[model samples]
Target: MSLCIENLRAWYGAAQVLHGVNLVIGEGEAVALAGRNGSGRSTLAKAIMGLVRCEGDMRYRDVRLVGLRPYRIARLGIGYVPETRDVFPALTVRENLLLGERKGTRFTTHEAYRLFPALEARAAVKAGLLSGGEQQMLALARTLAGDPSFVVIDEPGEGLAPHVLAQVAACLKTLRERGVAMLLIEERLTIARMLDARVAVMGHGAIRFDGPIEAFARDAQVMREWLFVG
Candidate 1:
């Protein structure tokens, strides 16, 4: 497994957010984590990146990730794209990509630009000046510039227009082809379907369902109880 989590628990100050979460991602595989609001999907991503106070086992390949800092985990080949799309507002598009580069990473600014030409067109513009969809693209592109072996992406398709979402999906597909494993966190199944990924449903800070995407589709009970909003 490229990434593995066993009995993972996390908290925000005194508020516990995760409860014994277990998951594994194989090399080059993509898993879509689906859930409604406040179900702890985002917490899982944060735990893996060491952003929250966490305990239990989180292993990235052979490295123990439990006590590591976020930057250390990132240097060990894990990338995170938070839902907030944390692009530097004052930085130009090219400068943002430059910051994401690592010592030996093969992924470069050229590849990032190729994946999203819109970003290249605005290379000289500050990130704060771009539209929301464009900012999202820049965030993803910046992450890719690091050439991470695994990535945890949170709410990637959130608030994106259909056309912009399609572009993001295409870029993710290309990454999968290049053997980068990913955990795609989302509330909607549209992008998951586009990626043909496995499904893992989260609720009450635990995994309620984990299976192939087709299995998730046929599980009316799981969908009604956990996914649908009445």
Candidate 2:
């Protein structure tokens, strides 16, 4: 497995967000994490990335990840594209990609540009100046520049237009083709369907359901109880 978690718990200050969550992702597999707002989907991503105070067994290819620092976890070939799209505002698009590179990474700035031509067109422009969709592309491209074996992306389709969302989905498909494992966090199943990924639904800080996407689509009870808001 690329990632394995057992009894995972996470916290921000005194408030606990994750509750004994367990999940696994195989090499080159994509799992879409779906949930309503505040259901701890983002918290799970943060826990995996070592960005939150977490406990229990969290491993990336047998490496213990529970107590590691964020940068250390990142160096272990785990990449994160936050929901906030935290690109370096002062840096140019090309510079941002350069900053994400690792010594032995197979992905390169040139490849990132090829994946997102809009970024290539604005290579010299500061990241802060890019449009929302363009910034989202840059964020994903920059993470790819690191050549991680696994990535945790939060809300890739949030607030994006249909055309731009399609472009992002295409980029993710390319990553899957290259055998990169991913944990895609989102509120809806649209992008998950596009990626042909398995679905894991979260509720009350725990996984309510974990199964094939087709199975998830067929399970109306699970959706009404865990995914839909009354």
Candidate 3:
């Protein structure tokens, strides 16, 4: 497995957000964590990336991830793009992308540009000036700049237009082809459906269901119960 979590638990000032979460993402696999808002989906992402305090057996290819600083985890080949799309407003697009290079993984600028042509055109522009969709591309580009073997992408389609979302979905597919595994949290089903790897349904700080995407689609009861929608 590229990533694994066993009995993961977390809290924010006594407001627990995760409980014994168990999951595994095989190498090069694209898995989605589908759930309603405030269901701990993002929290789980933070926990895996070591952005939040947690107690668990978190492992990335045999390295223990729990208790490590977020940057330390990133150095271990874990790239994280939070829901907020943490781009540097003062930095130009090129500089923003350079932040990801700290991981020391080799990747050509053209390689990232191929995944996001818009970024290529805006390379010299400040990241703060880009539209929401473009900023998302920048955020993802920054993560990919590191040439990470695995990524945790939170809500890539959250505020994007239909066309832009399609582009983002395609970019994710391209990343998967490059053998980069991912744990994707998405509100829209289209991106998850297109990826069509594995699915884990989160609810009330725990995994309500974990299996194939087909299983979630076929069992509407599970969808309605755990996901709160189809």
Candidate 4:
């Protein structure tokens, strides 16, 4: 099972952003989408989750997903961790994570706790009171607690201290080992390199570079042309 897209296009109130983007992510594969700001990387991510109006073939595990609502997509074991940390401000850390649990689900917060020890240390604390880094962890943990088969995670390293960033990286690595497919969007090329994922560089609302990360990394001309080296 995997996500397969063909000429995906998106619009925001008549303003088209994504123009015929195509990509793929097989089960347990991690792929990074990178480019300069407004390159349609995030727009493509939102389109996959049906958070915006889109056209073209969007399939997940062989099921068409272009017209599905965001919640419907989520129900199919696809998780979206937006750029914002969508936490219940007044809810305790445990409560926030528990809220993500669905009936008959096998995933639990115990795994989340193992991924970010700080979350376990403050299980009873209000989520709003945690630092930016901890809140990011909570948001991710909460989503993963539902046992998503595929995840689209936007930039999670923004505004975090070095140690906290490392924690996020470790958590992602763990998820990969657990066989969760991932679509990652990040500005830091170094972080993208760490995932050993194929790189899809977006430009002008379309994918301009699609290949192995090493291939993308080695091409100084393409890297600089697409804002990867510069």
Candidate 5:
């Protein structure tokens, strides 16, 4: 499925963050959204998932998504894993993943375990006690369990150790190979490079730059101006 956003605007109460943002992630494509804090990257992600008040077009596979409830949007095969890595404190890892399951068959629990062995190993443990990286894995695995055609993942590698990060990357690679579209919001340039993804730089609630990573790299001005790199 394809995800297309055009002239998107979002607000938190009275504060507007995204200012006419436009982006598109075609089926089987992966795109990275990078920016400094308060640049509206997270807000845009939330808007796409119907988690925030939004105006403008948010479409997936030709169907309009604006004004839909968050769950309704998920029902359309779009999954969101927020940056917060919120897991059920009282639920076991298995239970948490089961909660992500849908009525139709998708990524089965067995497949999820194969993709994320650490989660399988700790299936009986309470999700709240897992390490931060583990929690992030659980969150990603749970979202993928729904077999979403497209996913909006926020900061999946925020604080992972090197090994855990590799595991996470591998899991995501499987999804990419399966042609699952992804919108990844991340601060780490390395993640973008690893995915070999097109890059979009957001600044002051708008997309300041959108192009191949190579172009963004070649143009030092974009990094300096939008991202504060010297």
Candidate 6:
């Protein structure tokens, strides 16, 4: 396994948000963490990135990731893109990408541009002026510039137009071809199905179902109760 979480737990101040979340991502695999909003999916991603206080055995390859600083985690080839899309507004597109190249030893800006062609066209433009989808692309591009072996992406499809989402899916496909593993948190079943990745359904701070995406489509009761709780 490239990433493993054993009984992961996290809290916001005094409130516990995650309860014994267990997960694994094998080498070069894209895995989806699927659930409704506020279902602890994002929390799981944050906990793995060490953005919040957490308790559990988080292992990347052979190294234990728990207690490590967020920067340290990033240096260990773990790239994280939070739901907020933390791109610097004042910087030019190229500058924002430069900031993400902190490691000074991994993927190049040109590589990121190749994955997101729109970014290449907007390299000279101010990052703040880009559309939401473009900002999301820049965010992913910035993370990719750091050359993480595995990526943790949170709510990537949120607020994106259907056309833009298709572009994002194509970028993900390219990432897979490059052998970059991913732990994706998304609501769109279509994207999940297209990726044909492993899926884990989360609710109330715990995983309710973990299996193939096709299994999720077949289990109507599971969808109605856990995945599609509308």
Worst 10 residues of 2 by lDDT: 102-111
lDDT of 3: 0.87
Per-residue CA lDDT of candidate 6, range 112-171, in tens? 787678888999999999999999999988888888889999888889998878888887
- Which of 1 and 3 is ahead in lDDT? 1
Clashing pairs in 6: none
Question: Which wins on lDDT, candidate 3 or candidate 4?
Answer: 4
Tens-place lDDT per residue, model 5, 2-100, is 988899999999999999998988898889999999999999989988889989987899999999999899988999999998899799999999999
Clashes of 3: 0
- State every prediction's TM-score relative to the real structure: 0.98, 0.97, 0.95, 0.95, 0.97, 0.94
In order, candidate lDDTs are: 0.92, 0.92, 0.87, 0.88, 0.89, 0.87
Tens digit of per-residue lDDT, candidate 1, span 154-221: 99998999999999999999889989999999888788899999999999998999999999999999
lDDT of 2 at 132: 94
Error of 2 at 114 (Å): 1.0
For candidate 2, give the lDDT.
0.92
lDDT of 3 by residue, 40-104 (tens): 99999999887788997989999999999888898888898999998998899888878676545
Question: How many clashing pairs per prediction, in order?
Answer: 0, 0, 0, 0, 0, 0
Whichever of 1 and 6 has more TM-score, that candidate is: 1
Candidate 2 local Cα displacement, residue 9, angstroms = 0.9
Off by over 4 Å in 1: none
Model 3 TM-score (2 dp): 0.95
